[model samples]
Target: MNDVTTDHADPRTVRLLVALYPARYRAAHGEDICATFAEATAGRPRSAVLRECRDLATHALRLRLRIGPTDPAGRVLAGAAPVALALAAGCAGYFLLPQLRELVHRIRYPYPGLGLGHAVLDATLQTAYTVPWLLALGIAALGRWRSARIAGGAAALLSVGVLALTGLYPYTAGQMATMALVGALVLLAPAGLVDVTRRGRWEMVGLALAVALPMIAVDRYGAQHLLLPVLALLPIWLSAVAAPALLGRLSGGRPDRLRAAGVGLGALPWLMPLAAVAAFDRPARLHTLLQYAGACVAPLGAAVAVAGAVHLARRVRTTDPADPA
Candidate 1:
């Protein structure tokens, strides 16, 4: 066919969309992709065309991210994914309680100050932000891959609308951002990375409970006992310190690079709560203990990511002189 489409679709836009794929991919099927894009979106509305474009870009970006099991980022993700899911699930579960409690309180009272309107809004927000994480994690852990993706992607989009509608962006930005990242991870993570054995799936659920219960306890009562907080931080600490070395040893090579990168990615979700705790719950002594730990860790995690990128660049250069393979 000619470079231009007779069907009113913009040829230039079609070319740009196809260009987002890898050069190898482009070389193989670029023309067909462009043609199909043109044909499918030819008579669609602007919104539909944009949606198609966004979907194409997203898939292209996912490919560029090197989400396969072999790459360093992919490896780190595979290692960190379970932790991310569990922590996200735990965090989501923890936050859900207060919202439920508040909703109940508002319903029970229905006082002048505590209107039914407030209860409705809080319930909607909770459903939007908190419930989806739990749902996605459950569905993913149950090995329902398509359902997990749908649950996560839809939830993330729905939460955006809810937050925007409620006009509570400023107040809930941090929690919303954290939860949104979780949804994004669920949506974008490779199936190879997340689809684990039945035992592994159960372990993920157990870890989620391990994270959520202590956190819930700490929230319910003051930080009077150190054991609770210690238990909460234990999974992160063990995983961060042990996981990299374990992975490195298992892989049977120079484990330092893997270890370094693992430290950063692995510790991230676990440390997130500590960062918040350190900020608002400074009175808790655990925050101070974690404060010193984070200071040492923060720099290392940054270095690991930088180091991984540099290393990958060198590998790509050696493997494919023309372009990334």
Candidate 2:
């Protein structure tokens, strides 16, 4: 283990040499790296701190992907929003974006007046618009009626309409309905939350029905029309099921009470827009996701980064006042 010491060595060169971590991480580690650099430099400058930090950050990313998650604390420390957004974008871009392009070609190339950019923009907008509508319909079905006679009836009707209009029977609307249904049951905490438990079981049934209707409709309607929506809903359904369980473990309640509470609280922010989408059948897709990313994720990421930055900034803050002539 080598020790570090502070001594002159063309401080600018020393500072310039440590600039290789991601800007945010680099800024945090520069001083410490620089101090180590000073020791290694001895009476002369060393030139590889920048390269070293880059390797370190890259290695860190690899380690994260390999290590099974321990708790939400580990995630919180790593920055959850960026990680989730990156993963979502990766999955969507890989799967959905190309199909969306084909849909764009079908709509725009039909007419000659539009520019290439306009066609792309139009497709993006349409896909984006549909997300909210699906979300809205789901919430309305889940929230408005609780009985099999009422809730299932309403979900069935809406499920059919969404399937017809979107050309997929259940779609994201059904997925949202499923999430709401699960969340509602969790709220009930059946057993102790007996009524809620029963309702949750029903909700699961509703979600399954919502999901099922589209598959049946697709078989009836054919694959080209049905496939895209199936792609979209699969992620949401899986996420809805898995997220709560993962969140519960992260929240640290053996019976999952705290996990349920945290999820309920976290979910409240999206409720209004999500509910509105369900009620109105408006598509808020990419826009809603973007809004969540911007309003929710970005700010949180910034706040964490800023806090870290400020901590560094305080250390770097000048201790001496201006010197008199």
Q: In terms of lDDT, which candidate is strongest?
A: 1
Cα TM-score of candidate 1: 0.59
lDDT, candidate 1, 170-210, per-residue tens? 33443455446655665665556554689657766776676
Q: Which parts of model 1 have CA positions greater than 4 angstroms off?
A: 1-16, 28-59, 68-70, 98-102, 154-177, 226-325
Please identify model 2 stretches exceeding 4 Å from their true place. 1-35, 39-72, 75-87, 90-98, 101-110, 120-239, 244-325
Model 1 RMSD, rounded to 1 decimal? 10.7
The 10 consecutive residues of candidate 2 with the worst lDDT sum are 186-195
- lDDT per prediction? 0.61, 0.39
- Residue 192 local lDDT, model 2: 23
* Cα shift from native, residue 109, model 1 (Å): 2.3
- Per-residue lDDT of model 2, residues 260-313, tens digit only: 333333323223334444445556565764453344333233433444555466
Models, CA RMSD each: 10.7, 22.2
* True-structure lDDT of candidate 2: 0.39
Could you tell me which residue pairs clash in candidate 1? none
